[model samples]
Target: MNPTTTALRAGCSRGLIELRQSLTNAGELLNHVLWPVLMLVTLFFVRDVSFGQSGFLLGTLVLPSILGMNAAMALVTMSHLLTVDREDGTLLRAKSTPNGMVTYLVGKIISVSGGLVVDLAIFLVPGLFIISGLAVGSVGSWLALTGLLALGLAATLPIGAVLGSVFTSARDQGLLTLPILGMIAISGVFYPVTSMPEWVQWTAQVFPIYWMGLGMRAALLPDSAVGVEIGESWRHVETVCALGAWAVLGLLLAPVVLRRMARRESGSAVARRRERAQRRVS
Candidate 1:
């Protein structure tokens, strides 16, 4: 059998093992259930509230937007987990093995993306009951949603790996939380992007976050809701283009970034990071 093919198979098995472990881990289980449950509570409260004069329920608008935000969040998860593995010397272990880095990355992407899918289902399933007015009954809605998420994951996961590569420590990765939150704020996950300033709209468009949210909205919202979006349209073409571009960029950058980061890893470096972490704790 081919070495690369063998590595891919190993990576897939590794990812599944980690995912199963997470499902059983008490802390990990809580983390998975918590956010989506909170989101459902939020959606429940807003189910009847109107979004300005748009006649659309705020809950309706927010539900899919939350889905988009969650999808984009795959980047954060990928980066955080990678950084944590690096700090704990797991990455160093991988570097010692043949084609281990590639295996490591594939496993992480699968683990993270799998977790996202579970979280998405948690939110979306109950969310359909909690909110009214979304186009939930159609096959098209499901197809659009499935495609958007697949693309969004493809778009964000490698970028997350790049971030993880650049930010060598968990503390360094922590610094990104604020900026990501700020991006979510402007990405119109919690609100309409058209309501933001024109410059804000343009700036947000440059990132995948906005496109993910837009894609989610297009998938789940009724056609009438398009009036509130930029250009009074869902801009499906633009959504695909923006997300496709990011997907390309991430795929291009991840290997280069990961290879560079992997080359820099050593037992001594891992020891130093652990020492620093211990010092911080003390």
Candidate 2:
């Protein structure tokens, strides 16, 4: 077998192992379950409340949007994980092995993307029951949901990897949460973008998160619910174009950024970081 092919296979195996570990470990399992559980509790409270005069249950509108937002959260997850692994010398060790960098990236993608799918299921399965407005019985709804999810992931994950490569420390990575939260606030995760100020709507439209949420809403909400969306339409073409642009840009940039970051990894650098981390902990 070609060396790269062997590395890819090994990477897939590593990803599976990591995925299994994440699911089985008590703390990691709790982490996986926690957010969805919280979201469900929130949904339980508002499932009956109607949104403004739109006559749509707030929970129904929010459910699919939450799904889309979570898909976009793939960016933060990938970024944070890469930063943590680099800090722990995992990247350095990979640099020492033949074809290791390729395998390492593939493994990380598998682990992150696999974990995300599980997280989405955790939220989506029960959400389907708790929310009422979704077009769950239709094949077209499911197909649209699946396509938006794929596009959302493609649009965010590579950019996340690039961001991860740029940040040198966990502290800096944590700071990223603030901007992400701000984006979510403006991205119509909890409400309609059309309800926000005009400038806010335009700003939200610039990010993949807004397009993702809009795509989900288009997929799951009843056609009548379109009354609350911007221009009172699903705008599928714009959603695809916006997400496609991000996907292309991220795919183009991630490899170059990752390669630069990987080249900077060394035994001495990793050792220094470890020492500093230990000192901080102590």
Candidate 3:
């Protein structure tokens, strides 16, 4: 068997194991459940909300956006995990092994993506009970939503790996959250992007969040709901094109970044990071 194929299988198994561990561990389970529950509560309060003269329910619109936001956060998860793994010497261990970087990254993507799918389900199940305007039963809705999710992970995880490798420390990794929060604001997760200034709309479109939200809405929303979307259309082609661009850019960048970062990892460096982290905790 090819070394790459062997590494891929190992990564898959490793990811499934980590995912199982997270699902079973009380602390990890809580981390998974908390945010989705909070979003559900928020939706409950605004289930009947409408903006301006548009008759669409804000909660219904927000439900899918939250799903998209959760999907997009795969980037955050991948980066944060990479930072933690670096601090703890996981990357160093991988660096010592043949094809380990490939194995490690593939595993990380699977674990993060699998966990995210669970989180989305946790949100979507009760979410359906809370919001009524969605076309939840449509087979087409599920298929489109799944395709968008795959595309989203493709767009985000590589970029995340690149960012994670670049940051070099847990503290710096935390800083990445600031820009993500800012992106969410403009991405219009809580409301329609059309409500933003034209310049803001253009800026948001440059990032994957807006397209993710738009795609989610397209999947779950009724055609009539497009009235509130930009150009009063779902713009499926635009969404795909935008996310595809990000996917291509990220895929192109990740290997070079990860390779450089992996080469930098060493036991001494990991120990120094752990010491710094310990001192901070103390």
Q: Write the residue-wise lDDT of candidate 3 on 83-102 in tens digits.
A: 88887888999989999988
Candidate 3 regions off by >4 Å?
none
Off by over 4 Å in 2: none
Instruction: Decide which is better by lDDT, 1 or 3.
Output: 3
Model 2's lDDT to the true fold?
0.91
Model 3 TM-score on a 0 to 1 scale: 0.98
Clashing pairs in 3: none
Clashes of each: 0, 0, 0
Cα RMSD, each candidate: 1.0, 1.1, 1.0
Model 2 earns a TM-score of: 0.97
RMSD of 2: 1.1
User: Residue 235: error of model 2 in Å?
Assistant: 1.1
Q: For residues 1-282, what per-residue lDDT tens digits would candidate 2 score against the true structure? A: 999999999999999999999999999999899998998898889899988998888899999899899999999998998999899988888888999988988898888889988988999999888887688889999999999988998999999999999887887887899999999999988878888999999999999999999999999988999999999999999999999999999999998998899899988888898898889899
User: Worst lDDT window (10 residues) for model 1?
Assistant: 165-174
TM-score of each: 0.98, 0.97, 0.98
